[model samples]
Every structure is written in C-alpha cells, then in structure tokens.
Target: MTASRFPRWVYTEGGEPDPRFTLANERTFLAWIRTALALIAGGVALEALSLPIQPGLRLVASILLLVLGLVSPLLAWFGWAASERALRCGRPLPSSRLGLLLAVGVAAVGVLVLVGVLVGPVGR
Candidate 1:
C-alpha cells in the first residue's frame, strides 16, 4: 500500500495547478467514478434478471462487468493523479491506458451479451 504503487495516494507533492484545471480534473475523475457505478449497477441488474442464458454464461458476463466496474475507479484515480502531476510540472500529460481498457472491455461485454441473445433469450 505504498504511495509509489498508487500515485493518487500522495496528493500534495506537486505545485498547485490552476484552480480551473484542478477543478476540471476533479470533475473528470467524478465522471469516471459515475461510469464505474453504472457498470456495477448493470452487472447487478443482469445477474438479478438471471437471464435465461446458461448459468455459466450469465455468471461470467456478470463477473466480467463487475470486475471492470471495480477497476474503473482505480483507473480514474490514477489518471487524475498523473494529469495533476503533469499540470503542476508543466510536462506532457501521461498517456491513458485506462481509455483503451474501457473501450476493449466494453466491446467484450457487448460480444458476451450478443452471444447470449443469439443463443435465445430463454436459452437452449
């Protein structure tokens, strides 16, 4: 649980960025958190529906989405910290790997849902 392992854990190291920029960064983080919450909610809803798909398929899809939801907040925090640091140091902002993960993960979820749908809503 060292700060080195989690940049956002150490929040006061850098010089202050412009208030507006800082506020914007905070908002961005909040938005990502919201997105994460939505994913978690969707996952729960899917599991609750107990979609007539195979039990294993429903479980796997729900678990995958839930994991993604858990990861999202961590990603948001890391991104916020990196951007804040770059702003303070006047350096180029760090690349966001989370953005790629989100895109790919969402596509994967879509595929899983499509497979379930094609298999028949009430399942075989």
Candidate 2:
C-alpha cells in the first residue's frame, strides 16, 4: 500500500484532536520506525559477522531480533492509532503495552546473544 494510503484507519474515527497531540503521536511513530530499523540492522550485522559464532544459536538470536524489529512498526501503528482514536472519542488514552513487550523482547535477545558469545562456537 502507498504511504499515503497507509494509516487510513486514522481518518475513519471521530473528529480531529488537538494538533499538538497529533504531532506528538506522529513523532512517536517515527521514533518507533527508527528503532525498528536499528534492530533490523543489528540483527543483520549479527548474522553477517565473521566472528566466531555457533550457527544455530546465532541464527536463533538473529531471527529473534529480526522478528522483533519487523513486529515493532506494526505495534507502533496500532498503538498510535488506538491513542488517536481514544483522543478523538474523548476516552482515556490506552496504556503503553508495546513498550513492555519490546523491553522483554530486547532482554531476551540480549540473553540469547550473551549465551551465544559465552558458549556457542566461534568463527565460521
């Protein structure tokens, strides 16, 4: 879908909220995209590195990171949309559930990588 066509769900809701809040939401979404891009890059680098690493474990770590990265943008959109819809509807803003999920995901990835470094095979 086109960039413009994306986030079409935003328009299907109630009337516009404050511009500042909308702008804040847009900024938060952009930040999440940046973070997702970084995670993908880290995953790629981990997989591509020439340093010694066990194939299966490194691959697992790589996959975990990559998957998290891929999921984040979608979460961002969902979070942003929900918040916007709430704002328009005058409902309480939703909690930051995505943040906790990401935190846990990142911690898991880190643990996997650490284990890979400490116990997995080195250079291919």
Candidate 3:
C-alpha cells in the first residue's frame, strides 16, 4: 500500500529523511509561528490599550508589527519545506531570505515605539 502525504510536491520528489530531523524541522516551524503570534499580539496591544504614545506613531508601529506578523508564517512554512527537501535530498539547508527582514521590522517597531514614548501623545 502506498502512503499518501498531504503536500505531494514536497514528499514526491525527495527521499524520506531521519525522523528526528523531521521533528526538529517541525519544532522550528512552531517556533516561528509562536514568534509571529507574539508580534501580532503586540500590535493588538498597542491599539487596544490606552498607552501614552503619539497616536500616529503608535498606529504606524502597530501596522508594521502586523505586517511582520503576517509575513513570518509564510517564511516559516517556506523554511520548513526547504529544509525538509534538503534533508531528504542530502543537500545543504537553504539560508533564510526573510529572517533579516523580520529582524529589521522588529527593530523598526522598537524605534517607532521609542519615538512615540519620547514624543508623548500628540493632540490627545
């Protein structure tokens, strides 16, 4: 009997890798998902709470966090699939293309928060 996997494209081409490696890849994917959830939570918090921040800046920072949150899951899935494919093919793992972008986005959010805090709420 032939076993069927959900993602045929990923499973069809490459050989099965060690189960441990596959589990590790799954863990990494979950970690990325967790990070994405944190970012999304932060965005919601910024808007939902009555924090003393410049209104416009807070909105911008919240939006930025949301965008990063949206992208992270996609990167996580791509990374997971790529790593799985490499492991099965005996090829070197691929480097993350969006990891740097995520870092920069988080940093940008930090800067926005700092500026908003320093400036205080305007027109409030």
- Encode model 1's per-residue lDDT on 1-124: one tens digit a residue: 2344445444556665788987998898999999899889988988899566655566777888899999999989889888888887778888875888988887887788778767755525
How does residue 100 of candidate 3 score in lDDT?
A: 98
TM-score of the candidate numbered 3?
A: 0.94
TM-score of each: 0.83, 0.85, 0.94
lDDT scores in order: 0.80, 0.83, 0.90
Q: Rank candidates, TM-score, best first.
A: 3, 2, 1
When 2 and 3 are scored with lDDT, the better candidate is 3
Candidate 2 residue lDDT tens string, 16-99 = 789898799889989999999998998899999964666777888889889989999999989988888888777899987579
Tell me which residue pairs clash in candidate 3. Answer: none
- Distance from true location, Cα of 20 in model 1, Å: 0.9
Give candidate 1 regions above 4 Å deviation: 1-12, 121-124
lDDT of 3: 0.90
Stretch of 10 with least lDDT, candidate 2: 1-10
Can you tell me which runs of candidate 3 are displaced by over 4 Å?
Answer: 1-3
